[model samples]
Target: MNRIYLPLAASLVLIVSLALVEGKMRDRWGTPGVEAAELGKRFDQVPKKIGDWVGEDLPVEEVTRKTAGAVNYVSRLYTNSKNRNTVNLWLIIGHSRDVCRHTPTVCYPSQGFRQTGDPLKHHIDVLGEEPAEFFTATFSKEDPSGRHLERVFWAWNHPNTDIWEAPDNARVHYGLSRALYKLYFVGNVLNDENTIDSSASVDFAKLMLPALNAALFPEKIADTVQSDIQPAGDAPAEEVPAE
Candidate 1:
């Protein structure tokens, strides 16, 4: 009877310990229970006219859309009338933080493009908005037909203040909370003489980021507008060099 009681007591203790650990983990890393469908935004409302550039919605392929695993996304091409330089915009609100790995680093390589170099980090201060941090990469693919070079800039945005390229940061900020957002800008310089000029992406972000912020955080727009008028010392500043 003593042996039986001792075994039962030990088993009960183990169960209780496991339960406590599970609870703590859930508190620290649990994803929100909200469905992605419920968080869809009206990307259709993004203005076609952003500054001097005009945008047109582009169709995302069925296979690509399904592979993205985003609850919703917006794909568009914006071209400046002055220079006719074009940039492609893609904003995705993923179904889960797992989408962090869906960056061009993986996708482009899989699609047959070889990555050219390490991703470059950049910060741009958009007027009337907080500084945005992003990563840029260039990919080149050669085939029997020809070679193609594409440059992509992207970031993970949070509802709160921080924006960065670190996946762990995004996981902690949005994955734990079960809300994730990502912005991507891609430009094809396949035919251009300057294949390394990445400024087109920056220029597009400058004009379109405001609309993106409004869509993602409509409640924060009034506060953002107020900040847009703040004095220089206290205001968010741009670190990007002039092109």
Candidate 2:
């Protein structure tokens, strides 16, 4: 009875140890759950390769949509009221990936990690469908003197869709080298801290941009761009009588 009991105890201990090891492995590499449609021997494949890298598993877990959070910014058109320019309620959704994006605007910036980039990545939030008149822009992490970080106002006037060489128009490069000395630089924003947030929302347009398609706006552009046509004198009325 002693010999049988000893073997059984050792077996039980070994089973417990193996279970512990398996649990740790699952936690580190994540057991992927599969869709109902793919149920089969293949269903196991997802869990097996979940946290695995190309061949071996990665050190960190793979970040997914579940790990992400989103926020919005509304950049306004400084120009016309009737044909106001507006950002398409820009979304600064945070994911494991270091990137910024918007859906309707179809613009994206190859933003780096939150640790180094804009504070808005963590502090701000996406605007809801409810109408809003103001944009929420904040840069508390940046230097109070405004010399260190770039603001979003530059993004409002010069966008990623620059008709020039800048193909990546959506991504606002906050490089200090060229931008530092400019009016839009961080220094200028600090000089007038009062309007920093509302600068993008101000209606600075001299006139409304021409409506899209002449058929749609009719001769509105003609009225705006082209001068009014004046009538010529009757028809040389008494010129023959004077001759």
TM-score of every candidate relative to the true structure = 0.72, 0.21
Output the number of the TM-score-best candidate: 1
After the best TM-score superposition of candidate 2, give how far the Cα of residue 144 lies from its true spot, in angstroms. 15
Reference-based TM-score, model 2 = 0.21
- In TM-score terms, candidate 1 sits at 0.72
What do the candidate models score in CA lDDT, each in turn?
0.71, 0.26
- Model 1 C-alpha lDDT per residue in residues 1-243, reported as the tens digit of each score: 999999999999999888875554344444432434445555656778888889888888887877876667888888889988888888876544455658888899999999999988777667765678788888999999888888888888654543534443444445443456678889876454353334677777877887777766776876757876867788667798879
Clashes of each: 0, 9
**lDDT by residue for model 2 over 21-83, one digit each (tens)?**
555433334333221112222212221111111112223223422222121111121222343
Best by lDDT: 1
Candidate 2 pairs with clashing backbones: 71-125, 71-126, 72-125, 72-126, 78-204, 78-205, 79-205, 160-169, 160-170
Cα error, residue 210 of model 2, in Å, equals 11
**Stretches of model 1 off by over 4 angstroms after superposition:** 1-35, 160-173, 190-198, 224-243
